[model samples]
Target chain A: MRSTRVTRRKLLRLGALALGSTALAACAALPTGPAKPTGEPAKTAAETTGLGSQPGPTTAPGGVPVKITFMMWAWSPENEKFERDRIELFNNSQTKVVVEPLIMPYEDMWTKLDVLVASGQAPDSVWYDYAAYKLIAKGQFLDLKPYVDNAAAMLDDSIYDQGFWKPAKMLGGDSPYALPIGGEGMNLFYNRDLFDASSEPYPTDDLTWDEYRNVAIRLTKEEGGKVVQFGTSLAWLQSWWAWVMLLWSRGVGIVDSHFSPTQCTLDTPEAIEALQFLQDLIYKDKVAPDPVQASVLSEQGGDFASGKVATMVDGGWDVVSFRSIDRFQWDIALLPKGPKGRISPFWIGGPMISKQSRNPDAAWEWTKWTAEEDGQAMIAKSGQQVTWLRKAREIAPEGAVPEHYSKRFETLNDLAPADVWSERWNEILDKVWNPEFDRFWKGEITAAELVKAIAPETTKMLQGA
Target chain B: MGRLARREALECYLFISLAVAGFLIFQAGPIGVSAFLSLTNSELVGTPAWVGLRNYSAMLHDPLFWQSLKVTVTYAVVAVPLGLALSLLVALLMNQNVRGISVFRTVYYLPSVISGVAVAVLWRWILNPEFGILNLLLGYLRIDGPNWLLDRQWALPSLILMSLWGIGGSMMIYLAGLQGIPTHLYEAVEIDGGGMWDKFAHVTIPMISPVVFFNLVTGIIWTFQEFTRVYVMTQGGPSNATLFYGLYLYRNAFRYFQMGYASALAWVLLLIILAMTLMLFRTSQLWVYYEGSVEKA
Candidate 1:
C-alpha cells in the first residue's frame, strides 16, 4: 500500500514535470510576426516546442482543438444557412478543427477587407479573390506554396491534383498564392425564343467574332425606328470575355510562356484586328449597341427580361437567373472561340492563408481541405458558386465513388483565363481596362487608344509596393 | 478649498469629462490621423511612410481629384441656391393664415428628417431609367425622357433634383425667420399704398435675408463634404462624371488605400471651404441684411 501511494506521487511528479517543461518551452519560444512579407517558410508550433524540426504537435496532451477563421463574401439567407449547416457537419467530423465564417456584402467586401488588413489583423483563412494577391506583397498574407508542398503527401494525387499546372501560377505562371475554389467564366446566355422567331441558331460555341456579328445582325429587328428585339444587350460589356477567347485564338495575350505580366502583345496588328472585328459587331453590323448607349446594367437585365435582346453574355453561375426568368425563354452555351483561341473570361475565388496564424498546421490542413474534394464539394453543395476542382477528375479509390458526382469534373474548368488572371485581373479588367474598353465600346475612343490607356493603368496596378 | 466644494468641482468635471474625452479620442484623433495620413503615402498593408510633398505633387497631376472637385463645386453651386430658394418659397407660402397650416408645416419638414441614403434610393426609384414612375408619367406626355441617374450628363443634375426633395430642414429654419418677420412691417409697407408684390419685395425679402445667408454658407460647407449619395448612386462613374471631392477622398483613403493622399486632399478641401466661406462672408456685408445695421467705417 505504501509503495502504491509512492507510485501515485511519482506519476504525478512525472506529469507535472512534463507540463512544467512544456510551459517553459512555450514561454521561451513565442511567435514573432512573419519574417518577410511574401515568402516566409511555413513553421509550425512543434518547431516552437523545441521538437527538432518535427513542425507541429501532431497529437495533444489530451486532444488539441483548432479554430480556423474562414471568411467569404456575404451570401443570400438560404445559401448562408446551407454553408453553416455544412460547416457544422465538417466540425463534427474533424474534432480538432473548427471553422468560423465571416461574411460581408460582395461589392463592399474588398473595401472593408482592405481596411481590415490595414489594421494588421485578418482571419486565419479568407476567400481571397486571388486578384488581390498583390496584397500579399504588401505583407497582408502568407505564401501558401510551402504549406501546400507539405500537404502534397497527404493529398489524393489522382483526385486532388489534375487541374493544377504550375500549382502556384493562377493564370499562366505568375505567383501562386492560392488554389481555385469557386468560379464562373462568361457564357453566352441568349433568348432561344428570339432565335426561333428570327430563324437563327443560338450563338453556340466555336463561332468567331465575325460569325457572332452576322448572327447578331440577323436577329436584330427594327420597327418604326424602334428596336423591338435587338440582337444583343451589352451591359457592363467590355470585350474582356471576348478578348480572352479571341486573344487566345490569335495567340496574342498578356501572359507569356510563364504566367507573368507579358508586354502588350495584343498592342500590335493582331489585337487591332480583333478589336476591329468586335467593332464590326457594334457599328458596322449594327447588331449589338455601342454599349456606351445602353441603359444602366440594372436596366439591361430588365430589358433582357422583357425580351429585348436575343443574345447576351453573363456569368455561368447565374444560370439560375436566366432559368428563373419566366417571361423569356433563354439558354446558355459555353462561350465560343474568339479570334485568339478557345478561352473565356472566368472569375474565381481562391482560399488564402493568413500571414499570422496560431496554428499553421491546422490552417494548412484547412487549406488542403478547401482545395480537396470534400472542401470543394462542401462549397459546391451551397449552390452559390461552382468549384474549379476538375470534379470529374476525382478518381475515387478503385470504385469507391458514386458515379454521378464524377461527371461534374468534366465541366469544372477553374483554370480558364479569367480565373487564371485572378485578383488584380478585376482591377485591370473592371477598373482600368473595362473603363477604357467602355470608351472603345462607345466609339468615344479607337481600339488603339484603348490599348494605349491600358498600358499605363495596368502598369501602375501591377507595380508592387 | 473646502473638501465638499472640491468634491463638487471634481464631480462636475467628471460629469462633463466623458463627453470631452470621447470628442478628443474618437473625433479629434481621427481628424488628426486623417490629416497626418494625408501628408504621407500609405500602403494598404504596411506601415504608412511619410512622403512630405509626394502626395501633394501627385495630387497636382491627379485628374480624377480635379474632376471630383469640379463635380462637388457644381453640385453645391446648383443644389444650395435651388434648395434654399425652394425652402424659402415653401416657408413663405406656408406662413399664410390658411386651413391646416400645421399639417402643411409638418409635410414640408418631413423630407429633411429622412436620411440621405433613403432619400437617394427613393429618388433613384422615382428617376429610374426604364420603368420609374417619373418616366412613365413623362412618357404619357409624348416625352422621351433621358435616363436621369444613369446618363453621364444627367446623373449629377438628377442628384441636384433629388436634393430639392429634402429641403425641409432649411424650410423649417426659413419658416421660423418668416414668422419672426414683424407683421407690422408688412402693414407699414401697405400703409405706404404699396401692393402685395411691392410690400413683399420691400419687407419680406430683407427680413429673412439673414436666414438665407446662414443657409447658403452651411449649404456650401455640407456640399463640400458630400459623399454618401454619390457613393451609393454612381460611385463617381460613367466616366467619373459625378465624381465629387469627398467621394474622391474616400476612394483614395478606403478604396485605393492612399490614406495620406486622401488626408492631404481633405486638408486642401478644408482650406478651400474656409477661403470660400470667408469670401462669402466678406461679400455678405453687401447683400445680406440683419435686423439693424449701421454703415461700415
Candidate 2:
C-alpha cells in the first residue's frame, strides 16, 4: 500500500529492482556450452561427393545419432570445404556418431576453444598444432592410448612414422593424446633458374655446411653495388623453432635434453659456433639477407619465391605457394649437413579429443578413422601435406609439383620434432630466446653474450619455474 | 517537493533509465567481476581457484612486467605532450579562413577515421627499412636510414612516430575549441598593443585550456593502451624492445592463458590511469580556465 502511491522514490526503487533482476537473469541465462558456430554449416559430404547411398557404420543405440562437435580453424575456403568433406565422409561412414564441424577463424580458434573447455562444453575433437602441448600439460585431452589399445586394427602403431608418433606420445608423458595425421619438415628449397644462371651446381643431399656457405657466396650477384640476387636466404632463422635446426645439425641443442632438461645448452662452444656462423652470414659474408632486407624481400613476394634468392632453407609446405610460380622452376634438397649430422625440425599436427567431450568414445572413433588408410588416402589426395602414414608417403607426392618430391621423404630419417613439447615452449621462445637472439641477428650482441644473457632465464623456465 | 517538480524528476529518470541500466549491467558489472578475477588463478580452462593477491604480488618480481611498464610509461611520456603541441598547432592552422579550408580539414581528419589495422599495415610498409618510403627518402639525402622496426634502438621510436599519425582526432577537438573563442578577446589583446604571440598566449590559449586538458587526459590514456601497431608490425619482437603493457597483458590473457594475472595487470593499469587523471584534476585549477566557473575563480 505504501508504494502504490507511485512516489518518485518508490519508482526509483522499483526500477533498481527491475534492473538488478534483469542483470541476474542475464548472468544466469549465459550459455554454458560451446559457442554457436560463426560460419554456415557446410554442405553434407554426400551432397558434395555424390556418395549419398554409401554404407556408413551401424546406427547408435535406439537409432539416435550420438552428436559430437569437431572444431578446427577455418584455414581457407578450400581447406574448410575439404575438412567438411572429410567430416561428411566420417558421417557417411558411421551412423553411430554425427560429428558437426565447428569452424572458427584461425586467430580466434584457440581462445574460443579454451573458453569452451573452461565452461565444460569443449568440442569432441579439435585440430591442434604445436601449441597443443600447453593444453596436453593441463590434462585437457583424453588419453588416447586406451582407445589405441582397444582398436589395434584401426589404430596400428607400426603405420605411423615414429618421428611423428613419438612426439604425440611424448607430449602426454607416454600416453598418446593424439593420432598422427601428417607433418611438415624443413628442407632446402632452391631456384633451379638462379642456380643455372650462376652456372653453379644445384644443392645435393650430401652438401656440407662450409660448402653451403661458399655456394651462397658464389651465387650472390651484385648490380651497381646493390646485391640483385642473394645466394641464400636465412630468413627462416627468424622463427624460434627453425634456427634450432642449426643447433640440432651441430649435434647440440638449445637445451640439455629434448624432453627433460635442467639447464640451458646454448652456451656450449658448438652452439655458439653455429649461432656465430649464422650472424657472419649477414654481417661478414653479406650473402644472406638480414632482418631488414628480409622484410623488403617479403613484401615483393618472398626471398626464395620472388626469385631474388637462389636458395632458401624453408618448410616443405612451400610447395603449395611455389606451385603458383611460373617464373622459374624450383625443387627441394636435403638441408646442408653440419659437422655432427644432418638434422631438421619436423612439425606435426593432428586432431585431439577433448577430455570434457560428452561423447569421447565417438570422438575417438572419428580420430582413429582419420589415421586409418582411408583417411590417409584422403589426406594424400588433398595434396595439402605430407601424410605421416608410411604407405601414404609413397603416393603423397604423386601429382605434387616439387621436382624432387622424394627429397621430402629422404629427409624423414633426419627429421626430429623441435623442442616444443614442453608447456613452457611458447613462454621460453617469446620472452627469452627470440628477443635475445634478435639482438644477435642485429649485431647488437655476440652469440656468446646472447647465450650468456638468456641462459639463466631459459634454464629457470625449463626447470618449471 | 511540489507535484510538478517531482513529476519532472520522475520523467527525467525514466528517460535515462536505459543508459543507466546499460552502464550498470555491462560496464560496471564486468569491472566488478574483473576485480574478483584479479584475485584468482583463472587459466581460461578448468575452475578458477581463489589465490587472493598472489597474482598481484607476482608482478613485483616479474621482469617482463617491469619492462612492459617502462615501455608504456616511456611511450606515454613522450607521445602525450608532443601530440598535444602538434595538434594545437595544426588546429591553429586549420582555424584560418583560407581557400579550400573544409577540404584541408577533411584531409587532415581522414586518417583518424580509417581502421586501425589498415593504418598499421600502411605504417609497416612506410617504415620498411629497405623499400619503405622513409628510408627511400633518407637515401636521397645520402643518409642510410637505420632499420626502423628491426633495430632495438629504433623500434620504440618507430611506434612513437606512428602514434603521431592519428593526431587529427585531437586536432578536430582543438579546432572546435579554437572556433568557439570570441573575436573580442583577440581585439582586446590587439588594443593592448600586443603582437601575434601575445594575442595567442593571452587570448587563444586561456580560452582553449579546457580542451587542451581534455586532450591531455585522453592522449595519456590512448598512448598507454597502444597495442595494434606493435602487434601487427613487431609482435613485441626484435628483442621485446616495443613490448607495450597492453601487448604483454594480451599475451598473458590469450597466448599464455594466464587470465588471472592479466586481470591483475588490467587492474593495475586502471589504477595508474585513475591516479594520473586525479592528479591532473587536482592541478587543473591552476591551469584550466573554465569560463564563468565559480571554482576556477
**How close to the true structure is residue B291 of candidate 2, measured as C-alpha lDDT?**
92
Off by over 4 Å in 2: A1-67, A74-100, A153-162, A170-172, A372-378, A394-400, B1-13, B47-52, B187-195, B295-297
Worst 10 residues of 1 chain A by lDDT: A45-54
- Predicted model with the maximum DockQ: 2
Q: Candidate 1: TM-score? A: 0.80
Best by TM-score: 2
Candidate 2 lDDT at A378 equals: 82
lDDT per residue for candidate 1 within A1-465, as digits (tens), equals 344555877889986676544432232211223433322346541222111112243333367667777767756775567656756766665666777877666767776566556544457777766535556646556666565555543234443443443433543434456655555556666788888887787664567656766777889988898556668765434545435556665667554422455333557667777776676666776776553235533454554666777877666555544445776677666555654445555555667777765555565655665555566666655444555454522323221221222222323343354433333544455457655664576677777777778866665665531
- lDDT of model 2 at position B290: 89
What local lDDT score does residue A197 receive in model 2, on the 0 to 100 scale? Answer: 85
List DockQ for all candidates: 0.14, 0.40
